[model samples]
Target chain A: MIQVKELLAILIASSLVSNVVLSQFLGLCPFLGVSKKIKTAAGMGGAVVFVITLSSAVAGCIYQYLLVPMNMEYMQTIVFILVIAALVQFVEMFLKKFVDSLYKALGVYLPLITTNCAVLGVALTNVQKEYGILAGTVNGFATALGFCIAIIILAGIREKTEYNDFPEAVKGMPMVLITAGLMAIAFCGFAVLN
Target chain B: MSKSLERLYNGLVKENPTLVLMLGMCPTLAVTTSAYNGLGMGLTTTAVLAMSNMIISMLRKVIPDKIRIPSFIVIIATFVTLMQLLLQAYMPDLYKSLGIYIPLIVVNCIILGRAEAYAYKNPVIPSLFDGIGMGLGFTVSLTLIGIVREFIGGCSFFGNELGWFAPVGIFKMAPGAFFVLALLCAIQNKIKIEGAKKGKDVSKIQSGCNSDCANCAIDCEKRIDDIEITQEDIDSTAKINAAAIEKELAAKGGEK
Candidate 1:
């Protein structure tokens, strides 16, 4: 049981110091693919936030109560993936029924979230770091927000680059990767703040 | 000489998972900060990929259709955890540097994508070769990127000090990563386009490894290997398209 202050620290650390995509490379697929369009980026970000938080919270508890007690901690990866896959399914249904607008924006990307790696990455990291339930959940939520921030910023940049006249060879994917490198350099500035 | 050898050739070049197929970008980018790190990650991934492909191929028929993806994930996660323990016990330094990536292999697209697209459908021998070919392809690209970054950024090649040009420093940084990878890709793309002008197939060297597995489409190139993707094979492979195919075959009565 972490205090409120420590929880905030974990959140900030995950969202910045160790960003899931930019620094850690946990969820580069959605980062590169969805970052092409702001709308899809936001939609995918929303789904990630939902699924990662819910799954991590549940995974933390399972690790704490079940795996720890049973000494089957080695099973963390398999167990967390199973939870995440199931949680993603539930979140998909919940979004379609309750948040119809979000449903449409993120409908196609929801299933993809199951295999996004970031979600499972968080769950496993939380276990590896030995964070308690509440702390792990906060870290997971913050990591997804970090992903959200990175993708939206990349999308905004990409949207502007659409009109520029890049060299023929450096036009599409190559240019985008170069842009990400620059963004990563800029983000590295945050390392000082920590 | 044989179909198995063709599969190996296809994986190494024709359908190189890293350079051409573009699967598993996360590790390719994050871990390639140093040549030694890159080689360690690449070899670890290769071992897991080869073993998992063999196991998955052997048990392909046993796994139920409705729960294939989850089952595959379970299998992959188990292998990854096993690798993690082995690495930690033997190579603690490498394991420490690799950190979370070792476990995150559970989500590496190459392993899952190959298991889904090739291993699950093909026989055990070819699938094993496909895994090796693809794994070797990934290792080669990763080591290449690692060598470039290490030499340019740190003034070393495979950890040996070169004592040559001044290390630019940024070449080892994240932006440098993007630059080197982009440079390689751009050159490959240029060659491919130029090759196409000569009526030569350059698809094999077109692009670098990209992770497109989480939401892979039915027509993903990885799925359609050198083995011509017939309608029946496509239907069996893609769950999303299976329904549509059922309705189509039902309506068309063996027409397509």
Candidate 2:
């Protein structure tokens, strides 16, 4: 059983120290692809937070109730993936019907989240660490927040650099990568908290 | 060259999943803290890729069109789980080091991309070779990145200490991964430019950006059309568009 204080530490640790995108290296596809503007980056982050938190809780329950009880712990990967995929589809439908504005903002991202490794990574991490439903959901939320933070910062940097003159060789992708590297260095400072 | 050999050469050089195509950046950056870890991750992903490609190709006709994506995910997850179990049983050290990344391989875009692009339409044998080619390409690039990071960051070669010079410890960390990759990419871009200047067939080796900024539709003041376009630029853009059209036609032909 994780204490409330330990949960707080996990929230901080997962968000800052071991960031999902910068440190853990999950979800680089969207991190790089959707980070051109701060608005889109924040939108992507919000969608991720919603999806990951819900999926983590759902995946936790399914693993606990379905996989473990059946003594097929080895099937968690397949089960979690299918569950997450189904959950994303359902969430997309739910948002489209009930929350039209949110659906517009997040709908494009929900489909992409299916292939995002961060969601699956957190689900598997929860299982490996043996976190219960509550703890798993909190960790998932924190990890998504970390992804949001990292991408927003990268977007801000990219926006600022959009006008700057760069060397021909370091023009586009390399420049973005180097900026991400510096951000990673800044985030590495959080490791001292541990 | 035979079609299979062409695929092998294409993957190994022309369209490397990691270096050129930039498909699987997650594992490329995370598990490359050391050369050995990179090699292990690369080889493991290769096994999964090859198997998944073969199986998916064999079952292409049986799978329905509307539900192909989920079907691909299920097949990939099954293979990924099998590989995870085997690694856990035999290579616990690597298993521990790689950690969540093993299962995360199911989400690697390169695998799904190939399944959707090549294996779904091609014959079984060529699809199998395509997987191996792409897998080898990914492995080679990863091992190269690993060697560079490990050598610079750890002052070691595959975990053996050299103690010859002071190590740039940053290279071993998260930031170092990005820096090394950026440097490598910049060097690659420089080589491509140099090759283009020499009038070699550098158009075949386009960057991930593809250098066709006009059609990208980004509303930037520095867009390619806003700037003075060169003869070489037009030629390369034409080549890229032609190749793209050829690919689209082939895909349509396959559907029929």
Candidate 3:
């Protein structure tokens, strides 16, 4: 029997305890790549949150309705990526037509999101967890929220770090990484919340 | 011959896909917890990269320009699937260790970047070598980071449980990955600065100029009517400067 409480627990757990970035380390590229500035990081985070949530639902439907029935589960990776690429393209066009501001804001990051591992990771992980469609979608949204939260927080830290003093060797990427390490360590405390 | 060899060598050191370009960090950091895993993941990526480069370079003329990105994805996905199957059948343990990263290779920027930047313009042989060289550089860097993390975190090299070495335990966790990576990057930075100071013959760096200065000069010269350091430009420049120190080091082969 799946309880609502258990769903919430899973949602919270995936976001903080098993964070896509800090804990699972699935999307370090964007975490490090985009987090240097809070604005771009927020934009990237928003794009990821949007992509991961939608892709999770789509991937879940594909897995349950198609792959499992045809014994083509092994093709999940290729299939998921293809779906993601198509979805990103479709969304880009849709946004460009309907929401010009967001399209411009997310410009480069929108396409880049198609390749971001966090989105793919959540899709595969939802499969791994054997989540039902509803559960998977919720988990996907929550996980993306968690990722957005973590990255935004890291981006804020990085913004502040720029003003602070750091060792000459540890000034830039090194220092930011160390900050991420601390953030990950702090996030480790959330394991107890489960 | 020498020119092609120079391009190959440049990919390996001066313009490494992983360190210098920072193209494939997701797979590099995620899979490099141990040297064995690093080697496994690295070689798998390399094989896929080489095959994809050859195919893409050959088909560059035929593919439509507008649909090139999607075409590149399709080509890379095909090679990634082949590698996934090969690993699942032959090297199950390494396959298990690599986990989802094998498939994740489909999206690795290094592969697609090569297709767009190098392979599309180059001949098959040079593209092939570029793949191998970048792949080796990635493998070497991953192994180096893995060695440090494994040794410091678990107090074990590879998977051997050392009785004499006390495990830090943190090294095995996610944060350890960041810490070790950061330290390696710092060391990489130090080496590059030292090399530049010593006047080593590195072609990657434009010695006398800052990145913003170079870009500014280019923008000014190219677009005389346009504004050169817009707010967006400033933010990106700041980001570039922050990342450039480590990039300079990675270019010098001081990290791996």
TM-score of each: 0.87, 0.87, 0.83
Candidate 3: DockQ? Answer: 0.46
TM-score, cand. 2 vs. native: 0.87
Docking class of 2: acceptable
**Interface DockQ of each model:** 0.51, 0.42, 0.46
Candidate 3 local distance difference test against the native: 0.77
Over the stretch A83-178, how does candidate 3's per-residue lDDT look in tens digits?
A: 987898899999999999988877557765666677878898888779988789888988888889988999898877687877666777788889
- List model 2 lDDT by residue over B1-256, tens digit each: 3999998888888888777766677899999999999999999988898899999999999999899888988998999999999999999999999999999988887888888888888888888888989999999998989999999898899889999899999999999998987887798788878888998876655434232211111222123223334677888999999999999999999999
lDDT for each residue of candidate 2 in A4-117, tens digit (9 for 90 to 100): 898999899889889998998887767877787788788779988999999999999999998888999999989898899899999999999999999988876687676578
Question: Which of 1 and 3 is ahead in lDDT?
Answer: 1
lDDT of 3 by residue, B69-180 (tens): 7788888888888889899899999988888778888777678777877888888888888888778877877787788878887778788877677788888788888887
State which candidate, 1 or 3, has the greater TM-score. 1
Q: Of the pair 2 and 3, which is ahead by lDDT?
A: 2
Residues A105-127 of candidate 1: C-alpha lDDT, one tens digit per residue: 76767786776778888988898
Off by over 4 Å in 1: A98-101, B203-256
